[model samples]
Target chain A: MNTTLQQFNVEKIRTDFPILQQEVHGKPLVYLDNAATSQTPTVVIEALQKYYREYNSNVHRGVHRLSHIATDAYEGAREKVRRFLNASSLQEIIFTKGTTDGINLLASSIGRGLIKPGDEIVISAMEHHSNIVPWQLMCEDRGARLRVIPINDDGEIIFEAYEDLLNERTKLVSIVHTSNSLGTVNPLRQIIDLAHNKNVPVLVDGAQAVPHTAVDLRALDCDFFVFSSHKVFGPTGVGVLYGKKEWLEKLPPYQGGGDMILNVTFAGTKFNELPYKFEAGTPNIADVIGLGVALDYVQQIGYDAISSWENELIQYALKRLQEIEGLRFIGNAKHRAGAISFVLENIHPHDIGTILDREGVAVRTGHHCTQPVMQCFKVPATTRASFAFYNTKEEIDLLIKALYKVIEMFS
Target chain B: MDELRDLYQEVILDHNKNPKNYFQMDEATHSAEGHNPLCGDQVEVFLKVDNERIIDISFQGHGCAISKAASSVMTTMLKGKTITEAKKLFEKYQHLITAEMSEAVDLHEYGHLAVFAGVREFPMRVKCASLSWHTMLQALEEKKEIATTE
Candidate 1:
């Protein structure tokens, strides 16, 4: 742990995000829904504006000056992503619509090629629907089986049970790196090692992890990783699918269109190399550029600083919220990140969310696309308050204050 | 802020706390489940219709204050009303909540159900307040499919 990085100046950091300055319902906005999507910084917003205002042109096609600039910027964003994830090569990073699109691409392409009838795909119980549904569709298509690795009461995956699920028949393992609703920081290093031991590939959904922690693909050695840009303070409609080069080469092309083809013919067409083969059609150019800048922004602030600040905030929040009568935390994983989910006694999360909104605090109220986890916890839904570096202890105080009001209103 | 007050009025809150006719009707002639997937609000409405009249109505499920209260109020207003009369009331209640009517409608016409007229102010929660009523419609029509506030 870097002590210097731990000294995060949150007040100053909040200045970069212009939207954080606004008020809601006559009170200053207290945005606690970072898990859904983070607030965009001015630099990222400016990057988007600059792309459209200046040399806006279709990438990879023209020899003209504007096209050259656009193509360079677009490709440059890929390089930025490669460095951000510490991937060995640019071919490993594929731009996607978001985490869902990335997972779908991997499932449709790699899954279609590898999965056979009776073959099993192992996923943890805490996976979001985005990760689960695509695999389910792939399994349905190929007559494959979907096996779930159950979690402990604290929402952390039982490592021994996960190991028990892995065998020669297990074709692939997909897991969430950090749970969006529960905030569990899974043991990905150990998980990857276990899967690798069984000669099985793993695809880690890092949508909720990327914003709070530093992810080094080389260190984790996951076969594939996916995350959304919007969740990391970038523009929406763009994400990354980081795949090891060997696996990407083996997978079939996700979609067929221009730029994805090397040679087109009346009878048969040849596909392009690694990343481009998966990224079919014209992509979200401006948002990709914005994502690159957002990565740079996070890098400058440093993940250590962000993680340290957020850890303190969560601890403080948990303590304060525990003081409230009958409030129960849904996930109490020893290792957690980004979000905190809880249910107030005899009060629905929706009611609490509505009251919190009136107090100008935004929180996500529901199963959070992890209905399986909700079922595991035996709750209809949980109220989640996810944090970013820009969020403060003051905001947590406001949330606690508003929660008291919810109790009063319901009582 | 007044909109918030109207949305969570005392009447609505009371209904949510101690909902009336909130039991599964085992001998119901018609029944349907309503689900608001976005919020995980689920409601099951049961109706016992006799000679074009609603002899008994009850609901069972879990949801927010707005949804639970709406279901409670709906069961109270639906009992003893003719099928045609229930349909008309449903239409009028829908009109009041959606605020689609050009002319202002009298709250007295809706009686206790008028408490939900304040829901018109909250566009997002309109679904919450209407989930049970929509399920009630499905139950009355004897639709075998589940109703959703999508």
Candidate 2:
């Protein structure tokens, strides 16, 4: 409904993603799996090609011309990430494999450093396994406790419950900014403020959020935030982890390797400063460069336009899906972004996924790596359709039509 | 579309909707839990084996149609068969679903399970179709360990 979204040309946007132009199973591809990974724009792909073709060399410690070009582009990507997240300095941005790697780095470095025995780590029930497992492992290792904040039936985290769990012993609160399985966008600003009140640092898993919403780290003031490049139309195998300067400075380096070491001897090794300390061996250079261009591409389109357009798609999807008899939406939170999960009576999500795939409507059907959320919903799994800015009303209609076919086949 | 229809044949749908021998067998001589972590599909196979013969078999769990139907067909077919005979049938069934067998091979040997031959086209669903049978094998072996179709 926004004027900017109204004027936005979706057909042109679709053209940017070459994969969307293809047909699957004799029907036009209807890609609705943005939460898993978004289709890459040609510009991002071109950036990757240019990097490999023009200047391919290992970053840092190399004095050669190609190395300088590669290192400049690589570090430039870090600066791009810093600017994208609105962080204060490049020291805050650490390159990672993806969200999983980022969280593991923090859990190993900070979790091992600060967390003492009997300390408590708080996380929400709707967290992806990446967010949940790393903290669980940390708690297990440190003899600390991992406490989960419960969610309502609507999939929103209960603020009152979260407050009750926050105490002096609560050392850190790691939660998802937006749930991957459930589309609920947590009240992060309030959540951060609440944790800050208890002097507990919070790490936000923003893998799902960065793709769909506008995230300003300074504005949110969360201690740590992580997201993957592939989810934002960039290359896979690369992501960003943004930590507060104070936290990054205090935590020990995660992996000890070439880039992270200042000096090494039989006695001990001096670790490099903030960002480099966390980044160990050679990072995904080409993908990191591609990620920078991906961020620029998203910025070019603007988040306001993206969010507005995706919201329209979600509303249209929800309304049309509601018309199907016996269809139950899994997460119906008041505030949602990117994805919608649901189940039809007496039908398995896998079967639905198969039938939909035959119709060329690509959707994810499984526990979505949130088994606890699936158990909370009392279903083995739910079929999920995640939207992007390029998805249109026509695609929603196709999805609805596919669902009808699923129901007919099952019945 | 033909592959889809074959995968979800009428027989599979009927068994999935109303799975035969789908109940808890408290007095079972052997039992094993099967799990597919990928999709959260769980199956518990309970067998009453007497003198190397499977006198009775039943299953209890929740999964997709392929898995549920496969479990139903497995329970029905394994009953009244000797342990050695059951193992042979299991091998043949596994081959039927997983391998590209010649058309000359009589699928009637697999009976109700021939419907699942379509699963050969869907490589991912093979695990779903075989979860219960794998658990059944574990139960027959009297293994206490949980069977995981990882």
TM-score of chain B of each: 0.94, 0.94
> How much is the lDDT of residue B147 in candidate 2?
99
Which pairs in model 1 have colliding backbones?
none
Score candidate 2 by TM-score against the native.
Answer: 0.98
DockQ of 1: 0.79
Q: How does each model score on TM-score?
A: 0.98, 0.98
| lDDT over C-alpha atoms for residue B110 of model 2 | 73
Name the runs in model 1 displaced over 4 angstroms. Answer: A1-6, B100-105
Report DockQ per prediction, comma-separated.
0.79, 0.88
What's candidate 2's DockQ score? 0.88
Candidate 2 ranges with C-alpha deviation above 4 Å: A1-6, B101-105
